[model samples]
Target: MKTYDEKHIKNVVLVGSAKSGKTTLAETMLFEAGLINRRGTVEDKSTISDYHEIEHERGNSVYATSLHTEWRDYKINLIDTPGLDDFIGEVASSIRVCDTAVMLLNAQYGVEVGTELLWDYIDRYQKPTIIAVNQLDSDKANFSQTIEEAKKFFGPAVTVMQYPLNAGLNFNCIIDLLKMTMYKFPAEGGKPEKLPIPDSEKGTADQLHNELVEKAAENDERLMELYFEKGNLDEDELREGLKIGMMKHQVFPVFCLAAKKDMGSGRLMGFIDNVAPSSVDMPAELLENGKEAPCDPKGPTRLFIFKTLVEPHLGKLSFFKVISGEVSVGQEFTNEKTSTVERLNQLFIADGKNRNAVDKLKAGDIGCTLKLKNSYTNHTLNFKGASGSIAPIKFPHPKVRVAIIARNKQDDEKLSEVLSEIHMEDPTIEVEYNRELKQVILHGQGELHLSLTKWRLENIYKMQVEFIKARIPYRETIQKAANSSYRHKKQSGGAGQFGEVFMKIEPYFDGMAPLKEFPVRDTETHELAWGGKLVFNNCIVGGVIDARFIPSILKGVMEKMHEGPLTGSYVRDIRVSVYDGKMHPVDSNDISFKIAGMMAFKEAFHQAEPQLLEPVYDVETTVPDEMMGDVMTELQSRRSIITGMDNRSGFQVIKSRTPLAELDKYFSVLRNISQGRAKVSIEFAEYAPVPGELQRKLTEEHQKELATESH
Candidate 1:
């Protein structure tokens, strides 16, 4: 493969909501560019983007696919990403490596939930973006309504660069506003015909043409003055102004296309060639050491791995963007994060699953390296003595968790190793072993994510695993205060043991109260002593117990405080005062006092008001306006409190706080209610007390389970 200069390369990512025809648009683009002989359909499972077995079976993109096409003297690297919320991490990673994002909006549905989500991510990354209204030939397609929705969601920056010549089923041509020419399709349909504006569309065409020209003029001072003086700008002047506006992200040009029918794609290619920013025009900032380095191809080599893919057969492939300097095959660079030197044996430009090896890669280019042992996602690579490392993109924490148990004992030992490898491939996944529960828990964005991880374990690692529904980590606490004491008397053949402990137990202020009455005072001459004076200053001033044994008595009380009376769980935020005790010099030891202390704590904790605390999550969901009421009611039924609601273009955003325990199967439930139109994001919220009746039932159940396990 020949290496293209920065000016001839276009790195673009295709992003949108699920079922928005992003993959199909990519297929059409590739076909039109002459990169492929035939166009592959999603239903036929032969598309170039959805190459994975899982994606083929599910008919959705499970990962980002990279493909390159040559159009108008440029090599366009197109990345097609998943649209589902569960796989958003893939889209985010793709965006980090691409210079521009092409947001595909369903012409029939207008702006959907995922489209809004992808827009937010694109804005966060500050990437240049363009909108493609796809599926224009489908039934119920309304270009005007879709454009209105786009304007409402994306602001007034959205400008129409191309107008559809016809509506649904009749959509065969597109009129270029800048060129002021109509490209009409023949009734027999092969290539498009460049002709003068149709008589019927002359008025609307002229109006749209003037709007485009004015908008373009506003982007350039020279053009703006010319338009003010002459009442219009030439085609070349208008195109130049539009290009400048697009590069600055001041305008988001909208184009219409029927990706499946191969309509209006040729003109879209023209826009990409003329309007998109070249690598030289919009160079990426480089960071060497820690400070900003010049984005010079002649500088020291610097690249950061933005993503990694582990194929069962193809080893590990690391995709990265060069920040500073240039790299050629066989050149060694230091990985600043790991402090290890790695040599690039082979560098390639990835096209879907196909990799074309290149001898060298320059700055501002996205390429891949094969089998770099120490390289991982977000790791920076630079020359030795580089200043600081590049900052990595932030990923959201996994809110949903589940326990994974191997189907058999043999697979148990291999589970951890397999999961670790999986986590390395997708950093968004978190795998941990819960020591207290003795289970391996996998956390992800939602149930589908977890399920996919499990599926990978079985297919990729060849390990069969069973998923166990996770139990909430509930805690018990005392409600009221009570005072009690116990006596520990033990007689052995050699020595007799006798000790008495009197402890007053009270509810501590949620671990915030300071230790009371046990103040330590130090003078210049006094050394720290183990035993202290035991006085009941609340009543009689006289010592209630021997001062020597006070330390021993307190030791016993401390041990009991750790072991809760009801459950064996650790007790916290409670005050225990060792006001009175009796000790024998010979027989009364730390052991006897500790036993007495345990008995006293058991008596006091039962008397206090005890309750259970459960974890809650703050959930945000986006659904169609018609289904908002149903979703809200369902959340309420699950003990959720709606916090706020707002209309976002075509969808409704609902924010609520819900207990995690009540949301076990919420993913399936939400899908069922909204026909898979809703997407939710959750984060850990504060823990609150369980209801009285529920607390009682939980306590009883815990006791019964503990007893049965003991037997």
Candidate 2:
């Protein structure tokens, strides 16, 4: 394999809504570049980009697949990403390391929720963008409408470079605004015949061409002067202006394509080869320590792993972008995250399942290495003496979670190891063993994401797993003050057990006044691990209770706090004062005082108007104006409190606070009601008191559970 210089390499990530034909476009690009003799389609399950069995089964891309085309004078590394929002992690990882993002707008839909969702990542990274209006040959294709929507959502930076003379059924010609010519493709659609603009379409093409020139000129002062001087930008000048505009995110040049028919793909590839910014042209990579690492082949070697894949027979393949210097097989680097030395035993430029072994990859190149013991996605590896690491990609937090258990109890340990491997591959899928809930929880982007993980576990890992509703981690707190006394006394043994404790319990807030009924001698406020604070007051005046015995009493109180009196939930934000207690010196042991204190705290808690608090989350749902009523109605049914409302890119954003209990499979519900047109993000807000009815029901259920356990 030939290695290209950083200046001659372009990393372009294809991203858009699902069914936008990104995978088909990838296949067409490879075929047009002569990297492949024949093109494949997603329908035929032969496209290089959708090589995974799961993706083939679903008829869509799942994982982002990398392929490269060594076009004339340049090597364009293409990262074909899944368009579904559930697989957005793949998109995010691809965009972070790419020089430009080619966003495909399905002509039929114009702009969709998936487009809007992926746009968030592109906007955040501020990467140069190209908007490709795909499926222009579909009967329902509407290029003009797609352009208008792109401008509306992506803003005025959208600049049209080409337009289909006939966009629907018989679409075969594209008017190139930059070249002031026409590209008429053969019905088979490979290389296009360049022709003069016909007089019939000359007027429209000239107008668009002038607009393109002006849009390009707006990016650079020199280009603006050149355009003003000549009333036009020459081809070279226009390319320079567009490249600058793209790099600065001031212009998102748009093109039209019918990827399925291989129409306009050669022109698209030509634009990428000639116009797209290379990694060397981009700004220096930002580092975690607020430093920059310029893409220099002579600089110290640094590799940032963006994706990890574990093949059934191939072991682990770590895909990375050379942030600096160059890497070759047998080169050694230390993983900044794991602090383990790893040798690049093998290197290959990936083309779907094909690994073309290469000896060296220079700066700005993307390639994969086999069996890097400690390296995984988001990890940075540095050569022996090189320090510092690349800034890690920030994956989105999970919006849905469920408890996962192996169908066979004996597979529990193996399931855990497999889950870790899955998390290593996709950081968006978080796994945790919630000790309180006694269940292994799997958190992911949505129902589809979790279901895919389950499918992989059962199919690839050969483990039967079941997903169940995760229990809400509720908390217990008091609403008022109350006092109670308990005596733990027993006379069955030679040494009797006798310890009495009297304590007052009250709701504790950050700045609440101290108790006046009993003077607090020493205050010890504990920050509970679950949430909130527990303040223990030493208030036994006149030595009514020994100072040493007070800790035992507090220990007892903590036990009840861990297992709340109402619902066996963790208790928080309360103050306990032991104002008075009696102890038989000989029989008053730590166990005796602990028991008395626990009993006293529990009794006082019942009288303190105890309340159960359920975890609440801040949920923001973005939906079209037409579907807001349905989404709002569904949210109301979930007992959601609307906190705020906003608008973004023609979508209405509804922000609400809802209890965790009401969020089970909430993503699925929202998808159904909005017909998959809505997007939601959830984050933990704060724990709030459950409604009276819910509290009553929960307490009853807890009592029944205790009754059953006693048997």
Candidate 3:
């Protein structure tokens, strides 16, 4: 309802481990800002941030919620994101557009696995961050210990800005080193009474204050010179220095807060309003042409969609950050990625699930609009024929996969439509129709992620679906060369079918010349659909077989390649030369030659020592040093070859090469082994030969399946 300039706007995101009171802190902030009359708790599932039904059922945030508050004339756009790493896309989207990130640490547990995982993205974006060690009222709260861990994990930049005098139970009083005053909040938790530091705690407070001053001054040259001359920085100078330090990621100020009780939030808000860097202070955004564009309201209109949510009644709610210029309602802009013009029919700033309609969104601000065709998350909307677009976000790859099918076959068609909608909302849920595997595979972060997807399908879409381990796409290739011939002669009635084919097969390699032992006219090559190459060198000598029947022969060979004879898998990497063949004048039709070529290729493939190639993955796992031995031992048992090991900040990163077949449901096993303190990412590597013993077993299983089908 009020207009704010870029200098008065602050885009912030609250991120940390689960149950760290981020949602409660947001609720308290909204309440204090006069946006809400009352604060809602997570136990009742009535908090503004965790308003979704699934979030209520899970008692935690499952998606990011957008909300804003006006604190002391500054508009703070706060996005509360999910703490579960499974839904990291939400966190990533929030970080992409935010100017600052407030990382909440649970005082009891200190730095956790989730916190460590989130640091990578925060570092990637290089956003200015503040550490708020929360839940100081709990019995297990250990502010000192938590700060020590934070410094150890996050580095020396985690400087102290506040210290709790009495943390647990009696956590109302805190000494603010930034302002050099002690704040004592009432038991009711409204406003705090600022008082001078007591004589008993003056020495400790002064020491901490000096450390804060030094940390701030070290980030800026002017401040460093002033500090060396005057022995300290004034209040205004300290804030200016801190702002510079924050933007450069040279300092991470830690504050104390009992968020649920609404203590210490007022001080935090004050700091954000007075010192946090604005969009103008940030570096210029890089465009598609590698040109930096400043945040100028007079420049071309550009908005980057960071997140998208599709509701029951609301079609598509797109959350975007205006990168340049002002966009009034009904203004049309070109979708840089799609090259299509889209009009913003209406613009609204998100308030949880509700919207506050705005006439215009200015540069360096976050807002949302609905129902834009041909636009989704990560798409940048700019003026027509603009020079460039904003870079796209790189989402993490899915770590777990399952083949899904509709329980009720009628819902199968509906399943695809709903899946597309889900994918639009959450890119982490990968749904693919793998023709080679003959199944639709759903890839997600872990089992919980897929379980939630199934729930949504059953409850929201009214569809029945089943999740099963996806079949690995194995390959079949040959090891040696062989020549074989077959004659297909079928005579039952008056007419007869007769054709003979002689083919020499050898393993194909890139840049190798096709077999030219005999004179040939045409050389046809086909790239196999899955992988490798297929070359047919027509070495038929003279007029042994008709040239017209050559395609038919190649087609027959492809049919066998589509479903290999050894294990029913796709075949690749082989050169076939039809050096010799026999055909009858009246009986040698396309069918006869095709059958003869298929039979001859199968015979030669079996004789050439056909081998099975299993898909392998390059896996990287980061675990605590105490659990590294256990994790490596477990991985070895799963037939994983350890590639390398490196150490990082009390953690171990182990890289390995493991077969995909051995990785089915491996995420759960990895988590269990490390007690949820480990993270893993797997990517497809080159296919390797299956072990001889496993190959024999797989062949036997294939034969049994064939026999059952025949019966």
Q: What is the C-alpha lDDT of each candidate?
A: 0.76, 0.91, 0.87
Candidate 1 per-residue lDDT over residues 1-711, each given as its tens digit: 666676677788999988888888888888988888989999999888888888987889988888878887877888899988777778888887777888888888888876766777788777778899988787788889989998998888898888787868777788878787887776434368898878888899889888888788888899899999999988778768887877777778888778787777777777777777765666355453356654566767788888888877888899887776788898888888888889999999887777888898877678899999888888888875454677776676775789989988887778877788777778889988875346788888778788888778888777888899876666555667677778889987767777776666655553335435443221111111211112221211245445555556555555554444544444554556655567676787667776776777677678777666677889998899999989998999999989999887778999999998888888878988987789888887776778888877777876897899999
Candidate 2 per-residue C-alpha lDDT over 1-711 given as tens digits, one digit per residue, 9 for 90 to 100:
888999899999999888888999999999988999888888898888899889989999889999999888899999999877788999999999999999998899888876777887888888999999999999999999888888999899999999999998898999899888898988877778999988999888889889999999999999999999999999999999999999889999999898888888888888998999998898999889999998988899999999998876678899999998989899989998888999988999999999999999999999998888878999999995578888999899888889999889999999999999999999999999998888899999999999999988877788999999898899999999999999999988689999999999999999998789888899999999998999999999887788888889999999989999888889999999999989886888899999999999999999999999999999999888899998888889999999999987778999999989998878888888887778888889999989999899999999999999999
Model with the higher lDDT, candidate 1 or 3? 3
- Among the numbered candidates, top lDDT falls to 2
- List runs of model 1 lying over 4 Å from the truth: 186-190, 220-223, 283-290, 384-387, 489-500, 508-578, 587-599
Off by over 4 Å in 3: 186-190, 199-204, 332-334, 338-345, 383-388, 490-498, 506-529, 533-552, 575-578, 584-594, 624-637, 642-647, 652-654, 669-675, 700-711
Candidate 1, position 204, lDDT: 90
The alpha-carbon deviation from the true structure for residue 167 of candidate 1, after best TM-score superposition, in angstroms, is 1.9
Q: What is residue 380's positional error in candidate 1, in angstroms?
A: 1.6
Candidate 2 weakest lDDT stretch, 10 residues: 111-120
| Per-prediction CA RMSD (Å) | 4.9, 1.8, 3.4
* lDDT of the structure predicted as candidate 1: 0.76
Quick one: how many clashes does candidate 1 have? 8
